[model samples]
Target: MTTNHLELSGRILRSRRFDSPAGIHHTVLQLEHKSLKTEANMQRQVYCVIQVILSGERFERLTDKLKAGVDIQVSGFIALQQSRNGQSRLVLHAENVELKN
Candidate 1:
């Protein structure tokens, strides 16, 4: 409902299999750090969601391309992820996730 999500960048700590009912496949990567600011703020220590989707013959291309300890940049909406135990967590739905310095 909100398009006012903040952008975050980091590295992948966790990568999971993401698939759809239409035979579309994707990979979810967990980042380790993020920068919070318009002009370049390096003090923010935030994590993010990085998803790499494969279209056409690009299925296994990005799947094994990215791994743990690799740096990445992510841009997406952040929201509260509710667990079955009633606990809440902030998660990211990365619209644009890429490799970076």
Candidate 2:
């Protein structure tokens, strides 16, 4: 069988469109932060992935820069996301979206 293929599945929590040195595009996300409120938690935070939709004008450059979220599957391999103190965390990068409850 072939190897070296990476396929990840996750839930989308946030999405937004932003401008960066790379460009602007739809960015998606999945968060896995632990619930500190629970002290007797047996399981670590799971994985999630959000969807993003950048403005039509700047979709290409923001593809990779979009930084979509990975599922619990890709957490170890992918760096745990972090934001500078006081800085807001970027969950996703999309201009338009519809979330389901």
Which stretches of candidate 1 lie above 4 Å from their native place?
Answer: 1-3, 20-26, 34-61
lDDT of 1 at 41: 42
lDDT of 1 by residue, 10-96 (tens): 677877776678867667666676555443745554444544332333545656757888877666676676779998877676566
Estimate, for each residue in 23-98, the C-alpha lDDT of model 2 and write its tens digit.
Answer: 6343444433333233476545544333223344644553443343422222112223355675443333333333
Runs in model 2 lying further than 4 Å from the true structure: 1-6, 22-26, 31-77, 86-101
By lDDT, the best candidate is 1
Q: Candidate 1 has what TM-score?
A: 0.60
Q: How far in Å is the alpha carbon of 88 misplaced in model 1?
A: 1.2
